[model samples]
Target chain A: MTLALYVPRQSAVHRVPAGGKLLALAVLAVVLFAVPTLPVAAAGLLGVLLVGLGAARLPAASLARQARTVRWWLAGLFVFHALFSDLPTAAVTVLRLLALVLAAAVVTATTRVTEMVAVIEWLCAPLRVFGVRPARIGLVIAMALRFIPVLAERADRIREAQAARGGSARGLRGVRTTVTPLLVQLLQMAHTISEALDARGADDEPPARGRRSPVTAA
Target chain B: MKTKDLAYIALFAAIIAVLGTLPAVNIGPVPITAQTLGVMLAGGVLGARRGFLAVLLFLVLVAIGLPLLSSGAGGLAVFAGATAGYLYSWPVAAFVIGWLTERVWSRYTVVWGVLINVLGGMVVIYLIGVPVLAAVANLSLWEAIVSGAWPFLPGDAAKAFIAAAIADQVRRSYPVIERPQRELAGR
Candidate 1:
């Protein structure tokens, strides 16, 4: 199964209110868009990095792993920008993107999925006046979060099986072969999960009643 | 809801987040991201209403500036870009996908489910996304499709099939959640 990506950390970042973190992320994104210089963007990125280090108390090693995953995309963005735009502009764009990404990564690494859902549920409370069901919405968020790792695990198993069967999915062709089976497996898994939900009285629940309350206590 | 159900939702959301973080394959204007897979699965497995809600939750995170999108792209500005159509179409796509799966393909085998899910989800997305993209990017309909929608087709199709197959398997192993009895009877 695709394991949950949340690194278990009892750090300041994790403890910070989800609302605050979300607000900060929004502000940072805006600044990145408004700022137009490489040096400035780079400084912004560095600032974010420093905050991440302090808030998440992320070990240097974990930071490296995160960087490694992003390296290819960063390189690709750099190359694309260099080819299409001026060098300085390209650098700034790339740095801006990186800063945004790293900041997000820090949030994900520290925040638990349940905490996110709680925050979402809280935020959607105002919609109750519009006849929205916060609890139902919360349920949906919860389910999607559950399915990711399950689907990932199934995908991994299928890939391994394909490999065992001598499937040479090493390049573009590999993507095709690998994706086809993965798709097939994903469908099957979804069906299984749906059935499980049905069997578990999923249908018995009444349709969300009266305008959903805006804030459901998590 | 039971704790298990709560757990399932939490798990799927995490999946969506992690998948978003993965490196994207930049085919062109629209980079291939894994959020679509999450979108499809959310609908197919959770049914229309719940699936829509899940996508909304994810989008809320994005709106608040979480870099939950592919390539660490998030924030309100991301919503104003050329790719906004695809991003915004997610909830609608998930609702359509779940509705179709429950209505048309509930009893079908993995292959049939995959086919319907892929076609259904893609059509809805393109229908909404292509037009919005054309308007935003100041491209003609055809040009928007070519630049914004075309590159993602093959990848999305793959995701659809994957979602269908996995959903089908999950149904077979646990037959209880397949569909409402009334719906099944109509089929």
Candidate 2:
């Protein structure tokens, strides 16, 4: 079975504040890219992998699974450098990429979506002075997070339908065949949802703006 | 904005994320994914402001460490990568598409939608994505163009056609734009 990015567990990594974790990730990246040595990057990759699997208590295989997706790109980078530059440079570059990817995975696996949303809302509070509403923006993000899994399930069903009809195409044609119908269904769903929202007066702006207070009107 | 508008933005953002999950067709370093079609639809149907907001919301989520990007990658590191230009181009791309769609409302034909998607969604994004990718990947400009833009042209054309058709069908079936207040009051 394909491993999920997040594994729900009680661990220190999970307990760390989202902001702190994000900060650590940024610092790690700065160090890795600033010092582009093979040994340095290799060390960083080893430390990140170890922390993900050990400190975070993530399953070793699951952590490795994240690396599996980028193996091809790493291989390509290796070949590119090998042909143009040198093997040492190629090794350092791939390691650098892998370290960054693993570090990101660690953050995602540990942090909850809600926590991140909270941090985002807090950060965006300053925009209120500019007449921006952070709460509404936060709601949009929360809703998007909630619907991602639902839509992914819908896509699977669409692909299944295509396969049943023996109409599945490969490569770019496959994207066209799958995406067209998927967009239609999603847009239709959005239509229904918008109607529900409007019926509940979700689109209405309060008429209180620009109105005088009771004392002023008197 | 109304709750309906917020819902639309959130729904489109989710659509972008869901599109990312589909396996990418590897053309070169930058694989072709279905997410850009979502970007096109967001602009074509939602109008400019909401479309831009929807994409902005997606990008923010990507920045804050959501594994919503193609290939299950996310966080600030992505902003420093070869694809960084493409990542950063999404909002402007959506805005342009929506702006074009709104101005040409009288003639909101499939042709118009296709043109907007190509010019705004594909071309604008590539103009930014190619150079940034070249700089980060250390490739020459011509090599970057060959590797990044050339193979995707035909697929993007197909995407543009289908995105326009889908948007046209959506507009006909369900009116997304707000009606005049008098018309609403009469109803």
Candidate 3:
């Protein structure tokens, strides 16, 4: 069973409203883009990472688990940048990237998926005037959250099945084999879901019911 | 939320995190990740509201600094990178996917769902991502689309079809929790 990276801690950071966190993220994103100085960006990134570590109370093991997948990419980027760009610029760029990723992960790990939905609903409330239904919007958000892990698991299963059937997805060839099965499985899965929704009468509702929300309240 | 629902959310989130662990297709500008497949499934299965919520959950974790993206990419800085537009569009794409899927509820046909997924999810991503790519990467719109949006189209289409099929199967086999109104209406 694939485990969500959400740590489920009752930290103050977790309690912070999703809207506020989003706003902060936006501000930081702006800062990251606006600032041109490598030193300043690096410093900002470090500060963000420090705050994220403190807020999430992340353990060494969890942190390692999180970083395990990206290490190779990071290494590749470092080497590529080092060879191409000046060392200082590459270091700064890499650090900025790492800091941003860490900050977002902290938000996801600490906050409940439901709360995130609530926040999105709240954010989209303003679109109601344009005919958006917050309830429907919330439903969409909830489903997206739910499906992430499901598809992930299914992809893994398909890959394993293909491998068992003498498919050697060992390198580049393996990559192609893995992707093809995953796609095929996904197509098959979508057909099954559409039929189920039809049986459940999902299509009877009017499209106007899905109008954009107008109020963006906190 | 009920325990079951919570369990469902946890399960999906885990799926997303695991997908994040997989190797990404590093084409230029933006790498294709399996997480988008997760995003598409969220919409196909959960309808509009819940599907978008799920993407928000994934984004929140990314905001809080967890490396929950393909190639383990996360952090506030990612929001400024070339792929930010695509990453940011996940929630909206899910919403669009769900809304469209809900529109074509024709008895679990994978093709219909795949059509909706592509039209709603992938199209919306490009609509939002292309301009953002232009601005962030300092390229023209055409150049950005060619570089950022064009490369991912094939992979995204595959994901859309897959999500549609999975959703169809789930609907057929599983006993979904029906909304009270739908139950009352007996449709």
Candidate 4:
């Protein structure tokens, strides 16, 4: 599954550092919610489009697909608001959400996953005082990203195998049969992977010396 | 934590993502997904702390702008959106499930597991999810309860029961959660 939204491109938007892009996204979200007006929402929507399609040089289809994915939600949100509130309010809410969504798409499409992880590490650095290992967290995130496709494939295989075996599994029995085997496979892989990780020094890293580091510096 | 513990957490996080890839029914921003089953499984299989961390890790990845959430929903936008309350409730729900599961580890049964999941995965989620839905979407509490959560009750219950039964099978076959500290003390 090409699950990542990143689209490799060499443009000004892509050139923006991951942290900067993420910060801009945060600000856009705040401004939209803090002042929910039709003009502001419309501007935000247009601005995201210009940056994503014009400056970022991202394929229009890529962003369009994202909008399509949430089309139902968008429609429902709009209808609910219009019925409950008013047309102007509905337009403001919808535009605000659409702009935020597009801006986020631009950010994800422009930045690499590793770069995003680095930003998360920086954000979590403050937690180091509580003995949290940001690197370990990064490793877990990377591992999860790497393995999602693998697990999805395994799930497919399990369904296929069940199909081959007379297709009797249905409802609760079917779900149980599928999930039990899938989880068992994951657990077995975890056993071997842990051994590999230990050999690869995943556990040997020095602990975060939150308490001792200050003393040592003194 | 041991290397194996870290791997379990990461793998469980991956499991959540994989489950999200299953077909979803979208009504509002929050879709009906098998993803919460993975959340229940995490707590049931990894116990409290690790289960919480696994779900948290998956959510952080979503927040990192990966399209890991069901229906390709991810990023700070989703977190800031109306459905953000449900997302916020996930880790806590997983934690509560694991905490309850660990307490009943010795006498665990499919029935017990299902009850735990329903309480944590459904009840707890609705507790936080409805209020946030109301506040963010600017609907009344009754409107939020009627629109945001009511549509989700049956599907969530099915998922809760399925997750519990799956946890029971995993426990009997290839249990991942270690004996809790309390269990060790009692023994």
Candidate 5:
């Protein structure tokens, strides 16, 4: 349920402003994907690894853990390209993907969720001029981030409960059975949350523009 | 927006992200993921606007480098990759699904739910994803079709069915579909 990639540490990567890190990540991604060649990808990979390990002070395992999920994809990508195209193209593609993932890992590991939310809110503040409530938007995003782990845990519980009932979520039927109960519970949870928010007057719109009606003023 | 609407938006976005954490079903280039099911549910249960907002929120986070996508990949870099078209189609997919659901709410049935999900979630998404993938990866359209759409048809059908079943059942029980007060008053 936890954000497995994030490990709190005091280092230069962690100290960098979230906006700056995000900007750097964007630039890094553009450069890697734009001119993707084997040597260029290799250089990008090395650069990301150096920043991840040295600047972020993240353990090698953290990087490995993030890469672990994509290990099969990398292999599959290579095979697909080798058969369809050539080894160099495959290698370059894999390297580019790895470099991007590693760079992302560094950013996520260093930046706290709250800091990320704040940065998002700050970035979206300009939309307030168009009657968009950046604060509300930010809060919704923050809430979503916070609930991800909780719901994931809930899913685990649902699966375990199904297992206890001698049900294995194996094939198509199993998926239906497992998903039905999970969605029911999730919807129920949503209803309860909305009710609680309503009880707290969350739906109450503020007084409109602080303007008195002409009739009332007269 | 009401707090309840905000709550729904946030919860559905979280649900999508949670689904992303599930182990991806590795296909050749694009992986089969539960996140699309989350997208369907967001639309079917939350109605169109909220569903769109929820997905947009998730995408914004992903754009900011959140590793919330399947296989822990995120950031603007992904926008340049082969799967970017699929990623970009999600919000529109959710919106279409939700909009259809909202329009058919009074006469909703499981059949309609399945149809809507398939139409919006699978067909709509594939419409956008295949060509973009071909362009990005420099493959022929036929090759892109082979890689992007053909392999996942059965699984996606099942996902659409399940998403519809759950959404329909939830609607039957909770009835969270938003109706404007003026519409209700007119009725």
Candidate 6:
């Protein structure tokens, strides 16, 4: 659950707004797709390294680890292309992937989850026109994040109960038995949580005014 | 949405995340996961709008760097990869499944549920996902279909049946979806 890879550092990259970093990453993807040349891809890779290591002052290991994790996928992608296309095309594809992966790593490493979520809230602000409430969106997202572990724990309990019955929790039967109970439990819990929300005056509250999380209840 | 509506959607999103994190059912070398099944169940159980929003919220969490994807990978980088097509199709697929499920609510049976799941979860997913896979992975459409679409067909079919069965059970035990609100083609 501790999925945020943000490494606290004192650098200008850390100071850049999360929205800007996300926008840049998106533009980089479009650029790589549009150019589709080895030089541009290679330069993209180089620029990512420079910004990540030199300017951001992130450890080389951090970026290298991201690349290493995707090494097999990169190799397979290259091989797949080489088999169907040409060597240079494979090179560009792999390089393009590497650049995108590292660029994302750089952004993830530099920005906090809260900052990224704030950016998300800001982006969703325009969706308010369709009777969509941005504040409710934030609250629901936070609630989902908060409840994932609770549901996983409950799933474990259901599996254990099935195992106690000498039932296999591996095949389709296992899935049905396990998930149905899990889902039933979830619905019951949802009922309670909604009651809690009403009890706490959640409906009457204004959209969250700032970075404070709206979902304070467990 | 009411507080109950928000809770149901959020909880359904959590269920999808839980399914993604759980171990997959390995039929062969490839693992057949129930995360997609969760998508179908969300639509089947929650109806079109709420079901659509549940899956959308899950993706939003994924985009915001939660490790909710089956591969445990997250963040904006995944949006650029070859698998982006499948990722993009999820919310739409859920919506389609939910929309179909809502329409057939009056005559809803496990049989109808399976058909809706197959139409939305399998056919619709591949319809939108395969071409993007071909374009991004630089494979021919045939290659993409064979590699991207074929291996999962059997497993997905099985999942379709299972999802339909589970939805029927939920409908009987603790039905969350309301009666069909609109006529077919109304929305």
lDDT of 1: 0.69
Prediction RMSDs, each to the true structure? 6.4, 6.2, 9.3, 5.4, 5.7, 7.2
- List of clashing residue pairs for candidate 4: none
Candidate 3: tens digits of C-alpha lDDT, residues A60-145: 56655545535677777777678877787667667766665555656566667677668768877899799766655565445545
Summarize candidate 6's per-residue lDDT along B1-187 as a digit string, tens digits: 8988889998989888877765554332123577888888889999888988999899887675554666444556567777788878878888999989888887889999999999999998888878988998889999888877888998899889989988988888888887754653476
For all predicted structures, in order, the TM-scores are 0.71, 0.74, 0.59, 0.76, 0.79, 0.70
Which whole-number lDDT from 0 to 100 does residue B133 have in model 3?
A: 89
Q: Per-residue lDDT of A1-218 in model 4, one digit per residue for the tens?
A: 43357999889988888999988876777677778889999999999999999999999999897687557766876787798789998899778777876887788789887887788788888998998887777767767776776887777777788779877576887767665876788888987988998898988876555756666878
By DockQ, the best candidate is 5
Off by over 4 Å in 2: A1-10, A29-45, A58-102, A169-181, A187-218, B23-33, B71-73, B130-151, B179-187
* Candidate 3, superposed: residue stretches over 4 Å from native: A1-69, A80-90, A98-218, B1-14, B71-84, B135-138, B175-187
Q: Can you tell me which runs of candidate 4 are displaced by over 4 Å?
A: A3-15, A24-112, A157-169, A207-218, B28-30, B181-187
**Model 6 ranges with Cα > 4 A deviation:** A2-117, A160-167, A205-218, B23-32, B181-187
So what's the TM-score on candidate 6? 0.70
Candidate 1 is graded, for docking, as acceptable
Using TM-score, rank the candidates from best to worst.
5, 4, 2, 1, 6, 3
Best of the two (2, 3) by lDDT: 2
Per-residue lDDT for A130 in model 3? Answer: 92
- The CAPRI category of model 6 is acceptable
Residue A166 lDDT, candidate 5, scale 0-100: 93
What lDDT would each prediction earn against the true structure? 0.69, 0.77, 0.67, 0.82, 0.82, 0.80
Clashing pairs in 6: none
When 3 and 4 are scored with TM-score, the better candidate is 4
Measured against the true two-chain complex, the DockQ scores of the candidates, in the order shown, are 0.29, 0.38, 0.12, 0.51, 0.52, 0.40
Better by DockQ, candidate 3 or 1: 1
Error in Å for residue B121 of model 1: 1.7
Q: How does residue B68 of candidate 1 score in lDDT?
A: 66
